[model samples]
Target: MNNIENIRPLISVIMPAYNAENYIEDAINSVLSQSYEEWELIIIDDCSSDKTLKIAEKLSNNDSRLKLIKNSKNIGVSETRNKAINLALGEWIAFLDSDDLWENAKLEKQIAHANKVGASFVFTGSSYINKEGKPFKGVFEVPESVDFNKLKRQNVIPCSSVLVRKECFETIRMERDNMHEDYAAWLRILKSGILAFGVNEPLLVYRLSVSSKSGNKFKTIGMNYRVFRSIEMNPVSSVYFAGVNLVNSLKKYNKILFKNKKIKRLRLTNPL
Candidate 1:
């Protein structure tokens, strides 16, 4: 029989929280309840003025696996995540937003699949949840495997749903500090010729709150426009692909508007 402890690699789960007092407990509990026991939860408090720090400290006091890191000042999410990455001591790094919760088997399933395929980065599907904790019917479809070319067309990898090998970070440093840091980081990784594998299962509950920056569709579109502009400036394959993605992004924005309209109608009729 394999020695479970010896064979299991330590996975570092990093959470960058700012004013997440309402949902941080659920996030912490989700990590603690993971079937993969050999993992550490690192919660970095990004100088939240709310009770987020107090809640994190309370949880850390109860569980030895949970750690609390308070930043001296409020930095953006990118800087907070990079700080957590620098402090991580595990072979693999997993990220969870303060408002997101993982399925109980998320880490176990992802780690197993990563080991099986020898993949450097693994991402899984996620179910969108509203602020009330109700799961939405709408789903995001991510490809099973992503190459450098495919990633250029669209960024299907969800930040909260991704688990990346520590070594991948060594080659492609996460330096993007824009509003769309996740997209920039993924682009950098793909540019370095690293491929990411995806598990089609919805292993995470992605919270969609009005308070979240990503919930602002217009801001996302503007940031994406900037991403394409940066990529177009690159000498290789810019002229063709950048134009393609620009059109695709326009279509995507239209679809999002349509969906929002339907959702609004449903809310009016159903009164929820």
Candidate 2:
């Protein structure tokens, strides 16, 4: 795959940039430092009012593998990602938010895991970090594999830690809304009777921005509920799943918030 004839790239990284000047450099640098070389990073700037586009342009200029596109107006993140997806030219489609960072071996290992498990969709466990890039209390654990029923109950998949086949996107693309569109896409893919596997290790560092929707418990809960409803889930099942999601969300933070000496330090690693 590293040969020049395979210049099409093994993975297409989709990054949606929206007022992300504060952390865009770190995000781009993280990708530039990846161990895997066969990847094309397509960064879509959603008409940012800040220096996000400028920084992205500079990074794109430095690396031919990186490309930057701008939207005529300020579309939401979901739409911006879809725009990039449409432009992807790789067998594998990976996602990396403009603010989050990934381990150097994230792509190489995730692709190997996908081939080993024969899965079209794969995600990894993640460690949470604060605005200053310091470790935080929330850590998400992942199972080796999950079926539709298991995923319908709770979203164990992290968007930033996912590497999906491009065909999956053609089958069920992401929703255009801002409210848990990633979760919705996961559920839709699983509903097709496809199993999504987890790497069982934290290959991605999830950044927690208080201003983001996921940072707000109340807003996140509401968005989860709406996502369930959007999938045509019955009211009873939707409420049940929402309750389970709430419990899982609390558990994520509790793992770190109540950390003790017995717990190992949370860091990105290929535990497998």
Candidate 3:
């Protein structure tokens, strides 16, 4: 029998919360409802002025598996996640954002898929939900696998959908808060020839809100440029990749708009 079949490994879930009072409870409860129970959720509140810490405290008090850590000052998401990761004890590390949710079987399915395919890092496809929790028209599916170069074009890995071996962080820690830190880390690991596997199902529920930094695609252009530079790619190369990133981003948004328009037309033609 494979070693995976014989072992029930513990998964450490990292959640960095900052002024997430509106959605933190549902995020915590999603982990609480996971089919796979061998996990510990570490919620690190990045010194929010809101009730994020208080809400996490209340939930943590009820379950030993829930651990709440408070920061003395407000830090960015990358550092906040690094703090939780350092305190994590599990062999595997999974990231769940304060405002996103997982399907009940997300962990169970992703873990199994990773073990069966011998992938150290795994991410899942996600379906979109608005601030009020209403579903978007379609799911975002990821390719079965992607390497370092493939990911450089566009980032398909959603932070909330990541489940990776903890040891992968021995040489990789999220840095450069100005850019996508998670993307930087993944690129570094994949640069060392590690291939990431994707579970092409909507195992994650991503909340779309204007308040999020990524909500405004045009605003992230400079941030994406910094991502290539952080990886030490030359100025000319970085510019090219940044342009590629912008084009791909536009393509993704166009798809979303097309779907929405199609839905409106269908309603108009087939209304009861």
Give the candidate order by descending TM-score.
3, 2, 1
Q: How would the candidate models be sorted by lDDT, starting from the highest? A: 3, 2, 1
Candidate achieving higher lDDT, 1 or 2: 2
Using TM-score as the yardstick, the better of models 1 and 3 is 3
lDDT of 1 by residue, 62-116 (tens): 9888879999998878889888898899999999988888999999988888877
lDDT of 2: 0.80
Q: Residues 170-268, candidate 3: write the lDDT tens digits.
A: 878999677778888888889989999999999998876434334345446667778789889998888888778778756665565576663321110
TM-score of predicted structure 2: 0.88
lDDT of 2 by residue, 10-72 (tens): 799999988989999999998999998889999999989999999999889989999899999
Give candidate 1's TM-score: 0.84
lDDT of 3 at 124: 95
lDDT of each: 0.75, 0.80, 0.84
RMSD of each: 5.1, 5.0, 5.5
List ranges where model 2 is wrong by over 4 Å: 1-9, 210-215, 260-272
TM-score for each prediction? Answer: 0.84, 0.88, 0.92
- 1 or 2, greater by TM-score: 2
Point out the worst 10-residue segment of candidate 2 by lDDT.
Answer: 263-272
